[model samples]
Target: MSVSPQDVEKVALLARLAISESDLPEVTERFGRVLGLVDELNTIDTETVVPMSNPHDMHQRLRPDAVTRQNDRENLMASAPAQDQGYFLVPKVID
Candidate 1:
């Protein structure tokens, strides 16, 4: 897949990018290389390839879900400037 300078300019405009005229050629060349890589990947056969969430076949080790700390809400809330009904009160910024 070949990319022209005009195509890069159009893409830059659409993406709101500030690519200068001096850099346009370089950018276009790089973009063309990326598309070339994609084109190369398209030639690879993957009909027999199996889709997987992970490459490893091992199960994830998980820790037991248990409460490790006591509830200290009242102690923490004591330092708040204003709180009501177990909820911190904040000054309304919008009318």
Candidate 2:
């Protein structure tokens, strides 16, 4: 698929991008190339290919879940400007 300068301009406007007049041609050309690649991909037969979460068949390496730090809420809350009921209090910014 080919992309026109008008299409590029419309896309830029929709995306809230500022594309200079001088840069429009290059931008349009690049967009055309990307669309062409997508068009090429559409011609491939993928009826037998199953969708997968990952490209490779492998399980992710995971670490055993364990407590890495001791809870020191009392010591940390002591330095706060204001706190109540196990929660830090801050100035209300919104009504």
lDDT of 2 by residue, 1-95 (tens): 88899999999999999999999999999999999999999899989998779988998999889988899999988999999899899998797
Candidate 1 structure quality by residue, lDDT tens digits, 1-95: 99999999989899999999899889999999999999998899988988667989877999899989998999999999999999999997797
TM-score of each: 0.48, 0.51
Best by TM-score: 2
In model 2, where do residues sit more than 4 Å from their true spots? Answer: 50-95
Error of 1 at 16 (Å): 0.7
Task: Supply the global lDDT for candidate 2.
Answer: 0.93
Ten-residue stretch with the least lDDT total in model 2: 50-59
